[model samples]
Target: MAVPNAASHLDFVVDPEHPDAEPFYAPSKRNYPQAVKGFYRSIKWAALVATLATYYLLPFVRWNRGPGAPGQAVLLDLADRRFYFFFVEIWPQEAYYVAGLLVLAALVLFMMNALAGRVWCGYLCPQTVWTDLFFAVERRFEGDLHARRAREAKGWTFDRAWRLVAKHATWVLIAWWTGGAWVLYFSDAPTLVRALATLQAPAIAYVWIGILTFTTYALAGHMREQVCVYMCPWPRIQAALTDEWALNVTYRTDRGEPRLSLKKSHAARSRGEPAGDCVDCRQCVAVCPTGVDIRDGLQLGCIQCGLCIDACDAVMSKVGRPARLIAYDTDMNVARRAEGKPALRRLVRPRTILYAVAIAAVGSLMLWRLTTRPGGALAIAHDRNPLSVTLADGSIQNGYSALVINRDAAPRTFDLSASGVPGAKLVVEGAPSDGTRVRIQVPGDDTREVRVLLRAAAPSGAATSVPVTFTVVNETSGETATATDRFETPAAN
Candidate 1:
């Protein structure tokens, strides 16, 4: 079977001899990547284990929040409109912190791409990680590439049928597990686990799990390379962002040109004829997850995984040739080597520095905001209808809604006062008030909405609107929060 190169849209070859030979499209074939062992493979294994372990286990970890607060280390509490991550808790009003995290992630990805092309795609992408795991299961059930191919050639036998069944069964199991692990993040893991086990979990949770299971199974098992090659937009974006200085999985064509078989190369060298180091073995292609021929030059299908590098190095060692026939190299370096110039590496270029600075700045800003944020908040809104009421006592009263947020672990009373309105008496709808301030209580880690009325003697020839400051002081800790709104009065005719 011929594996169609994803780099080419047409997947057809033009014959130079005929000049006008009719091109015929070749259909893509399923890739059965052969297993290979080397340094890069070891790194990939370690990364796979670490990432999967984190995903499956992090939800089970607990945090020690005070009583009346959820203790999940990381959770999105939709009911309470709060997001908690360890010691940090974000209210709905603080959504900018989440946006900052997203921005920081993008900046870090850009920096990684500037340093090494598609490194994130190759190593840490969810698609790649899941697909690699699926492939491992397939290999375990059906044997390696050669054995599977041989079995396919012999047609479907009982052995092959059973192996296929086992492979697909394992794939579905893993997909289910992956989906199940994801839902644990949104709730208390142990509680959710018991609910799920007892079949008492929420219908929405089960629906989400089913959706995720189907997606994971279909994408990782069947649409593995297709997702990377056709579905994802990152490859196109990365191509636009990359420059010549970026390190990519590249073939050193200068050293391996005029490819020949080992026996032919040996004879040619004996006759003092030109011969390249590459023995023309297709091991690199066989081991590539996307089945890309690295010798065909850098391609969109090449994920920069460095597996081809490992495969080529092993072959080179066996053939007694110097390694790194394929390596993490820049196009400029390849051109330099071809032109007999010393290869130059510019790791700290302006693009990388800019991305690094952006990541650092965003991360620092989010951290500073989180650390310095106050434990209380206040918001006030002036009533629109009947902005002000004229009482019989010749006083103007403005109605307002005040939301007081207490972020502390203990219940606290707040003294709410109004400023900017001279001789104003502040009153809470249900609470007692002194002439100057109203006292209201808020529960720990909760918000209280209170109707507030500010009354002042109507000034003669007074402005129609006056800016009023609403201040809430915590009676226990003396922490304060304030909001400003306009107190409207009747216009003087």
Candidate 2:
């Protein structure tokens, strides 16, 4: 042995700057997930294709709403205060529907969580889908995990430099298109597309597109699993929500204990010694997008994508052992197997049943409300300051404001009438010269506010405040809407 160099003298003691002495929570290590091919991998690929197609194509779908209304099916017309989704149209006054929809979405997520842990994170989330797309592009240009790692070790060459350029350029294009698709939902898709191409679109649209493009490229392409691990709060919330019965990506430690290499396992079997089929392979870790080793037990880094199951299955097949050494199972089931007891599947437990019932109840209530909705709406506001006025003819007059909402698809006149005291005549200040009980025309899918004067013969001994009923009847459809307000009077002078 040769004598130690000057650098070796301080090696015996811990160095604060050394990696081994650093804290456990170090900066994220870049993950180059190896390509996997199996059942779970196939399912992920299908999900990626379906979700991306829907995002890129749904804005182009069209729906006709008679005349002077948006033709795009899912437009959010902020300028006109309307939200259109296929056959449904929501006005600003009906904002409760949006709250209902958000509640429904939350309940659906809870029900899904009760059945399986974080399935949304694995397959349906936008982050997961876009990240998968970026990964595919990277792999196509840079080869697989081993090749990428080797290339990194050898430093950048001419071929590597070109591949990096092509990969980042593709990512930018996809990000730009994602932003472009988002803006199409706010205006007529074809018209906006032409405007965007001709550089005539509004400055706000371009600004939003630029913001989204940068965020998408940074989050999905550069941040990758860091977003899932550190940025998102779902992983922490999910861990608390998950029950012992909920199926999750799990490794069967009972089958994997006493791990040995392939040769050692075969030798142990021949000698009738205990041996596991794990074979000490790191395929599960290699295929993990987040670089989590499932054998290390569940943690926040695990997205429950099931790629480890595919990797482990392939390894098992090569070793002539049973599959599912890593699969979707519960921790309780894993413990049961270790104890030589029958595994339990409690999918229909009390919590899950309660969640399912809540979902059904909310859905049914929303459906019933939608089916029985009125054709229009009405509101009345009595004058605040001059509550009552005494006319020269001993008649009591009440000034009021009336708003009529037309929910149908065609313009129509509404017959207005007021009743409470006898001989009460309703007069529209600027409407047609029809004496009392005049008709006012309201535009289709719009609200009209107008001033109204209510006159009635003064009763000698009436109460100070009188309740009045205002009704608007649709002339063409015979549909009616009503509102009630109180008219106030002072003591007789």
Candidate 3:
């Protein structure tokens, strides 16, 4: 049997005699999604506006990050090797925060999938948002589905040609702006805008913008649902991750099966025959961006966007039937309803709870680390060659390198000292010594490497190595950091 509401390209026949024969392949057809209006549609519109506004306008939002720091609120300062998001600054060495963020995002995605299948792909994904915007632009220029199809059937006319030209031009313009907005995160937005406008931006920036423009145009304007259907991996992944309890854009077979037209259904009811609420109007298929028939059940092509819900609701209302014939539902609920049992909604099941707990744990750890981390750090490395030199005064001097990091905004003077070696005297290169400790100064938000020497009388033993602790105490804040390395001495000769 032919697939219900199948696209033109998919409407092909296989020989009944040769059941295993491959079906003829046809090129995919272009989709003209009809305009929809409903609760879910309103949600999508709000999400589109909020997301696009944040994307295009956030770079211009400024933050007062001191005099020397970049003022952009959210920036990836490659030159300085820093990621600044509002008050949070990430150094290259502290890359675990980024990893934690990615983990948190993945957990949240899993949780969303566990709660509602492919909700992210439907509402929040960049492809969906841009394609929705593109569709709006297309409707503005080329009219709705019927008008566009009618115009296409009439061959080339001035009306169709002008509309096509205008639509494509607007699509390209939107794609260009999308690309332009992306590059703003890497630099000061106002300055980069001026440079881009005057053609003074770096060649690499222009190259990236051009590449992004081409991709955005191809994916959103032309590819549209093809990207979701073929290119994206999320559908396959979510299929594996989703359980029967996960709510999806499901056609209620219990309510919609044995479908008939409105007039036929009325006559059948008069004859005391059973008839489903579905009128077989196919509005759900018409408004689908991916041209999927939700009544065929949960297929990979169903993005759970709920446009079909909106479309089916409209149709049901017109026929004076109850809404939600196509709705966010579950296979388990469908089976229960089919068995003449009440539907069950297990939104707070084990999998969802696990995902939520993981998200909260990771998010909390990252926040705690970000807020409570120290403003200074220390690292020490013992010299490999000539590990220790025996001076004429019978003192063993161990050469070492110490890196002092100051994460604060002001310069700090740290007192460097050594312990675990009796009678040890610290000597720092290019630093003043106060008999016991050496004073080293590190610039604000920078690291300073200094050569250090630990001189002490060898203990009266055959011990060739001694454990030594290196400590740096910030003079202003009394904050301290420590590193440990072994001090070596020659075996007794």
Candidate 4:
């Protein structure tokens, strides 16, 4: 039998009663995050500047696309059914490219999750960035967290009333600018700006601007963290994707347990007794935007922004303890510490490998298809009402609608011909024929449709179905496109 002291060598906390062993579940309180400076804070600041600049300025950038094309660098011209991004123009038939882009975006999100937990939510998400800006405005007009708290504690005052009004006025201006910037992408920015200044812009523009302004104010100014905690699906999906190795904002209970006041901790240490480093200062909680006590364990409310880390580090520096009581750490490290072993970190996992492979594969496929896509196309549709007609001379005639698309931005002529049936002749209605072929000029960046009649001199006992080929040959470049259709005949055999 093991002695009591020998058994105590194993690292297990003995609870005299079961009351303290229940699972942790605390009702969330509203967090009024205090500002702090650290590496993560600097990163957040840089991201804010970059993202906001891109959003508000990209629509005004110019891209010269020769003549008769919209010059905006990035635009979605709904009136013309065209999406222009620099040199690439997408038409209605290329909507699959947008679907592919969405798939690529999802894969990138998963990869970010596999590598770092909710880094996108912390820094890059529009909600987070906009809320951060609104908070800054609130601080500028109302003062820091404590000042606002004091003002709220007091009764209504004229000074407070004015400050409140000023703050809201600022918020509305920002929200309006945010909404106004969005509509510029759909039309010519300079023309729209002049029209809007003269109060002559389209009614649809005003309607969209009003809708977006209201939503931005409501979501960024009022909803704030509530949007992240209860409204977003990403949190649930992130929870599912996270693994033991992924770093999350966590509390190091091993270094912070048995928390006490600073004086009591010093007294305990003087007597050569064990005392944890944390003095229970509550600085981490005070600075957490989500009001999460990271020491309790990883919680869903934490956006993994590392603000608490900055707060706790400042506290540690003032109290003469090491920093990072709160940090981006893995659960595996926690378990290892509990087991009296060194922590391990692993970022190369199967999930990350899979995401990387998918990104690369899909990217390569898109590039290959874009580079090798056909520059011209031909389509043939046979007439349904009268599939075939027997002329007075006993020759079988078939009517078809032929469409030729010229993708290049240059005027070109194409010769339409028919083959695959012996003595088959082709005639294009409303087109001039040059002896053997019907030649038609197709304007640049457009498609032309022509009615075609195919006459085949065949015996009355011929088969019911015969294969026919219609070919369109570029008169200048000799590039050819062929479409196959069936020539119907009366069953006489």
Candidate 5:
């Protein structure tokens, strides 16, 4: 919260010795965005409430996934290296899903960018929502931007001091809860909440909560627009991704230019001279979160949140002028209007089509894989150093490491057998081995790796390597999975 004192304001003095020298960066200034009410503001409020509610309350929703599995609807079971989302279970080996999800998210963001520039930053970003809430808290405690600015100019009094403290205290509380809710997704939410309340939760949980709390407070409460301006990369990305035709928060210079006072405009109009609607009021700049002046043409600072549009619309209403002088329109359209051409919108452009197609393809593929994947799986890796050994009975043996997965509600007994090798026999260490196959019992929703040895008499003569498939059959459900490896025979000298 680098709220510099008025006394600390710098004097820009030019040096006689190095006359061409200039400051590389300007000094940071405080931005006090005033509240505005209009269509866009209402939309922002709705989005804030909905996103915050989903973030804070989603962990409480429970889902029954049978015994021995967590009931939390969304959980990352680190101990078991499993991820549960309602009925969907993702094993550690299925981490590709996370990568696929990231790709899908990027495509969706691109689609949004194509539709409307930086709309995600304006409405749906966590930073914007939390910062909006924090601003509301500030306004509640310290009054709107005007009062706060006046109070600061007059120097801090006892009431102002208390208000500042109260505002920050509320911000910290909200941030703490934000962080606390995040940890609930890793474990049972209700149980964790009880543990946290009683100070019985793990130390790591408290550490994470504290870290997130501090960051949230610093970023949302203190930094605010600076995060979107100096820190975020989305603005730069949006700049590259956007075109002249992409819709953005723009000031219609044609409609609002020739800036004049209301009385001057009236006088000019009566004299049959040209006059513009704009009264040179700074309402649009006063309401922007990123402190961007949309009238200065498109800049990197604007998040396209449309608060400026709302502010301009409110100003237009008060002045009895038509609304939307500041609007979500394209720069190309603005130029077209300046050139006496009608504005045209083409939403279904090539870039947008590409993004939509990519999103749909990836989403459909993920859904199909999720729904059609097998319940059980197996894999085998054969030993290299000692590929085969000739026993006293002239039998050939090969060692292997076998991994079996059990995606079931209850424990299962799996019978392991080898095929594609004549007279081959399977033997699993530490498991019941019969003359035909080896039987191993595995717990539900788990994977086990075991040492296995296969012995089969020489087919006719010594063969170098022969393809063999190891099959594991679930005795209860009769579900089976197989993996292939080489069954080696001793080479002839």
Candidate 6:
């Protein structure tokens, strides 16, 4: 053995003055969570029912878009490159709406983070939903935690083997149904279901179903908590976004410290000695889905599910003490209670205000743009080969490709007009015009491209390039759309 150093003796001095000394920490142990029932569980059940219903039913809901347009209420028609959501229709050119929706979603998530910890992860995430279903299957076949543990200890038997098979069969069925439901959103659900039953569905559809089935089974059944703890980036982002005032699953250390066994604590109380309310029962840890011990301080693994609170409340009721030993609380409040100070909360902080403002601003902007958008559209692409052509009539000519889009339910006439060069003659190849404007008949919900020729009577104007505007005005609605281009002429060397 080596001789003890003077530094070792100094380490024993009560409360050292050094600020950089690291505290000892132990790695967390894995917990096998037990089942419980309470108010939070009831709320979780309601959420599951609502979310799953909305997801699997909303696609089949129908909307009338008149003739020639798809009737599906919620559809992403990739073939036509259109996204239809009830009353709103998004074209490939209007991808900004999708971006706006994504921004709104992110802001909502941030607002939720500001109000509560990872409540979304525990209650609303798809990982949580599917895993809960898998767990229910496990319980139905293998029994609850106690019976499952006992069965595993007894090893494999005919009864156990058959139950295991049943369990896996049920899991696979649920996973397959999940995969099947996802494909319904892309096509007509009833039609696709019939095709699938007749084994006549597209090969690509079946391939996608198989891929989704495997992924769902592996992720929800096999991976479980590993996805939340090790794979997800949301937890880390939430950690950075969270403030001390944000509510989280917390252990009331102020009321539960100086822990002792139930019998010992009761004995100490009877003798007029100080003893904490905690019975060291470990019930809170036993009920945590992520195997986190709330008593160990606020940690990343805590999903703020409130199951531990239920477990501790049950324990407290049994012991004839007040509940809420483990409950939703804030770090600032916990610290205040520890320091014998009044609790303080600030929900209207800068971060929350910023998120709310951004969400409102983006939502309003998208709504305004959608409401005021014109029914007609125009685009012009100037020919690049020769830049400008010298016609036999001693005039400079510019060629362009013009596209006119009609976004209505009936055929509409649009007057196509161009302006830039004075005394320029305009001609549409496939249609006749009244010199200055052309009448183009555009079909309902369709776009038409036409070749346009612009001839300047002469190059006497002096400029080599000039700005040009192409306008298309719907004759019925008087709605107009304009696109800009440049008129190019040959250089005078």
Tens digits of per-residue lDDT, candidate 6, 145-259, equal 7887788778888888999999889889988888888888888777888999999999877987898899999988787787788788999999999989888988898998778
Tens-digit lDDT track of model 3 for 80-123: 78899999999877889999999999999999999998999999
RMSD of each: 4.4, 5.8, 4.7, 9.3, 4.0, 7.2
TM-score of each: 0.89, 0.86, 0.87, 0.82, 0.88, 0.87
Q: Candidate 3, 70: how far from true, in Å?
A: 1.9
Query: What lDDT does each candidate get?
Result: 0.89, 0.86, 0.89, 0.83, 0.87, 0.84
Residue 131, candidate 5: Cα error in Å is 0.9
How far does residue 68 in candidate 2 sit from its true spot (Å)?
Answer: 3.5
Candidates 3 and 5, the one with greater lDDT: 3
Candidate 3 residue runs with Cα over 4 Å from true position: 1-27, 379-402, 418-429, 433-436, 450-470, 483-493
- What TM-score does candidate 6 get on C-alpha atoms? 0.87
449-493: candidate 4 lDDT, tens digit per residue: 899888887734547878888888888778888899988875522
User: What residue pairs are clashing in model 4?
Assistant: none
**How well does candidate 1 score on lDDT at residue 141?**
94
In model 1, which regions exceed 4 Å deviation? 1-28, 382-399, 421-425, 454-466, 488-493
Best by TM-score: 1
What's the C-alpha lDDT at position 134 in model 2? 95
Off by over 4 Å in 5: 1-27, 381-399, 417-425, 433-437, 454-470, 484-493
Candidate 6 has which clashing residue pairs, if any?
A: none
Better of 4 and 5 by lDDT: 5
Model 6: how far is 127 from its true place, Å? 1.2
Which whole-number lDDT from 0 to 100 does residue 362 have in model 3? 95
Where does model 6 exceed 4 Å of error?
A: 1-32, 271-274, 381-400, 453-465, 489-493
lDDT for position 417 in model 6: 91
